[model samples]
Target chain A: MRATEMTPNDKTNDSTEQKIFDAAHELFVQKGLDGAKMQEIADRAGINKALLHYYYRTKDKLYEMVAKSIIHQGIPIIQKTIESDLPLEEKIIKFVDFYIDLIRRNPFIPLFIISEMNKHPEQFIEKILPARLPRPEIFLKQVEDAVAAGTIRPVNPQHLLLNIISLCVFPFVARPIMQMVLGMQKTEADQFLKQRKTEVTEFIFAALRPR
Target chain B: MRATEMTPNDKTNDSTEQKIFDAAHELFVQKGLDGAKMQEIADRAGINKALLHYYYRTKDKLYEMVAKSIIHQGIPIIQKTIESDLPLEEKIIKFVDFYIDLIRRNPFIPLFIISEMNKHPEQFIEKILPARLPRPEIFLKQVEDAVAAGTIRPVNPQHLLLNIISLCVFPFVARPIMQMVLGMQKTEADQFLKQRKTEVTEFIFAALRPR
Candidate 1:
């Protein structure tokens, strides 16, 4: 097998790098950049401090790499989905479903991204985001076209977009408070989030229905 | 006047305490509990470290006071508004308008609260939140009655409440990204938030309109 052909040293190196990356990602999400420590990350990765530094020289470098990887992971999929040739209604349904599921799988991302953005807006904008962002122009124009054709009610395209994204993202961002106030267990919270896929889509369409 | 009658020492003490409180609030909002330092807060307050410690014995105590003050300031107003006897539409309009305005004035509160909740849910829920929370039962019941009376379309009351809050709060929470993606200047962001009061209310009512 190809794996057997590789040296044992190569396999160990690959696994060590994976462990460091996973540990760094988890710590960065749980604690903000300034709060997470290099030594602690090393401990969590089950490696010594020297080996961690050998792979990633500094905490900032590790954080930057992790942040970049997350953004890269999300941006392309969003761009392709929004820029697709599907009709606006279908596009929205797909976007909400995809976004909610993505956040569900990586529940910490929303809070991590938002907190980092709050702490350093310029770094988030210039360094973390790709040169070409997920273009919303296509999505905005689609909404405008829908309104012009009297397909949806006359609404500010920007506000409409914000509303849709807000409905999908806020629940996860505010999950602790949501769980506390609603008296929801972990299982119930999962069920509520799943239900939002249908509830949010229908709510947006209902609001858009011509007067 | 009562101010004129006060001893000079009393006035200075009052202002000094106010300075410490304001400085601590600013630092806590910018950096989370663990990241904020007493010496930095003292410097920002234009006081010595000894004075800061004299005023608030420990960083934990200061943080608890700030968090408690923030929750207390918001809870009563929200409770009064949501529990008011106004019609459902009027109640929603009032809630959204009041909430957006509250957040606009205190832009850091949502992120601060949510971050603290994420970091220490037990501390936030058990200690910081008042024994009596801002009750949502009345609001939820109103939504249910509206749906039953055919005044609004069939919808889960919990989902409806979440939608209204998500629309109101998410914009502020995600303002940095929103500004970047939409290419909004500070002035434009202000205008957009101001517009949401009307926009969100109308959108919610439109969605709830009987089919």
Candidate 2:
């Protein structure tokens, strides 16, 4: 939200600002904050250096915008899905579906974040995530209620959430290693992920089904 | 094995080779292959540059040795553990236990591998992993047997293995983000991992248990 939220208040200003942002996002994800140059971002955006600077004054500012943009686009969807009023099974399917789709679309986000976090831990830990991050409590309560109603076996919601996240995220993060180990090419890897939408949902459902 | 494999016949030669290797390992991990320097490694090992070169010949050779050493140390342990004659539940537990412990002790390995693999995919995919990487067939067959015996519900073993691995590995790979989300300090993160050894194994068992 903060990503799109930081907009100038005019129609042309918004489009130019967005172009600058789009260019920054590509470069930052590919080359990282330290490796990316402001001049390169300007050229990529088809804007002059003065105009790019006018929009986002510093490289760090642009990098922060890109990070916030990515996290905003990705994490909130899961939080909103998890917090929705759908039944537990449907809610979880949606979560896995959206989370996997997001990762598939933005495969670079994880490595970029990990690399940047190592470079700027205090910024990520102290500033960005803490600002508007969603809590897992809503999903936790849902799990607890499901168990209380005997719709599912009693389980720790934290562990379950962590499991769901791990399943969805790890394949993307460890793709190279997993690809080598599984003997999957890129097309095969995509097919595997397609199957995972249902595979992961059912896997969790089977685990949670009462004895 | 490969990390310390390229050694001369003499004991003194072996120790010096190992010392050079130990120094190379630390530097390559911290600075990566491109960033690491032979002189720094020599300095770190308390050996002369001539000796380091005599052992490794070049940084690439040293990097290959380090990567092999790490993969050799880290991965085969899991493969050997899974292939042992333990029952399904116990085998899964051993996996989660050994895996989480391995990542905990060698926190840099995942990030380093991912980064290095990105840098040198041809080497890793074409050369390294193919040499002795474990197949998931044993685990897959074990799951099939469990299902046929009515000890567990029918499941795709590949998906199951991927889920199990994702649960175990993602926490370490995405620690910074997870740590911020969970609001955990270093000690709490360690405590959380300790709990996951049990939590993940049981979570999987609960899913696998026959209806």
Candidate 3:
């Protein structure tokens, strides 16, 4: 567990809100929705339960906020990279690099997303989807262009999209299982992913290159 | 859902074990580890919970038996494909076809593995993960052969393996989300997966071909 740099740019309002979110996120990650209690969140925040409810209103609302916030960690950057006018190869490099860094920053996000998504996927995906997420069309168009230019063999945009996502996300999503399989400690896993950023992009290009 | 085929001669101890497995599987899949009660499993089995315990002593034990039964749905076949002397292209087709059919028959397996593994990953993986569950060396050898034979481009076996698992598993892991995102029903999702089974192999092959 890395210590987050705690700066005091905190206005009174922002400080309280940050405290609440910090506490809530920790509990949510550890205990999940059914198991985590409101009182525990308030206690962890060092605030009264009344105050916790005053800010977040309900557990579902608090969770929705957390899910949306966590999803934003990787989603916006991936969207921006996808929308960028970069070449197909560079796009792959940038996306994987961005994700490796994001996972490094918040180690819990992928598992949190998958577990919660498992619990109520319809509600979660409706709130945010990769298709409606940001700039996937840009990515789809790039793949189409790459195939047209004979830079790669023909592929569906969805397959291209899923391939990138799976390669980048699976190690993290299955980190617990991976830690055992790879015989990696937490620090080593971080290093592995950092190395994997480049490894994945090269692998993707190798697979997609014209025969 | 498809009807399972059987011959009377083939249905000896296989069907008896299969009956217990089928009954136990329904309970575990629908209810999850902690949520599933032994009495419920036995009741579903049309026997006493004591009888259930006689077959599999502890709750964790039952979960493992069920998990092992489910993993046999596809993984051994995948490992076999990775180790086969077939060309990499045929191997990819074999794998994709296997996974699509595997998931189609047992939609709950991936979620079951992930969720149970999430709860006690070390135990689950230790109990279930083979000395190598789809070893990299085998896949790497195949990739090396393909690259050597000019059938495919260079790639890391590990990254490709992870990507392949993700493509096959994520759709089901995100089934509830996909159902909503595509405005799909069970039938629609089935059709969607069926379509992907055919196209996914081609897409991956296209991606793997040399530039």
Best by DockQ: 1
Give the per-residue lDDT digits (tens) of candidate 1, residues B107-156.
88999999888987787787799888777888899988988999999999
Model 2 RMSD in Å is: 4.9
Q: Name the regions of candidate 2 deviating beyond 4 angstroms.
A: A1-24, A34-59, A85-87, A126-130, B1-24, B27-61, B84-87, B126-130
Docking model 2 quality class:
medium
Q: Taking the tens digit of each residue's C-alpha lDDT, what string does model 3 give over B140-161? A: 6787777777776666565566
| Tens digit per residue, CA lDDT, model 2, A9-123 | 6536448888888889998886666557889989998989987768777777778778887777777787788778787788898889898898888887878777667656777
DockQ, per model, reads 0.75, 0.49, 0.33
Q: What residue runs in model 1 are displaced by over 4 Å at the alpha carbon?
A: A1-14, B1-14
Interface quality of candidate 2 as DockQ: 0.49
Docking class of 3: acceptable
TM agreement with the true structure for every prediction? 0.93, 0.80, 0.73
Task: Return the TM-scores of chain A for each candidate in numbered order.
Answer: 0.91, 0.82, 0.82
Question: Which candidate model has the greater TM-score, 1 or 2?
Answer: 1
Could you give the candidate ranking by DockQ, starting with the highest? 1, 2, 3
lDDT of 1 by residue, A87-175 (tens): 99999999999988888888889899998888877777778888987778889999999999999999999999999999999999999
Number of colliding residue pairs in model 1: 0
True contacts kept of each: 0.78, 0.62, 0.39
Task: Write the residue-wise lDDT of candidate 3 on A97-120 in tens digits.
Answer: 887788768766766666667666
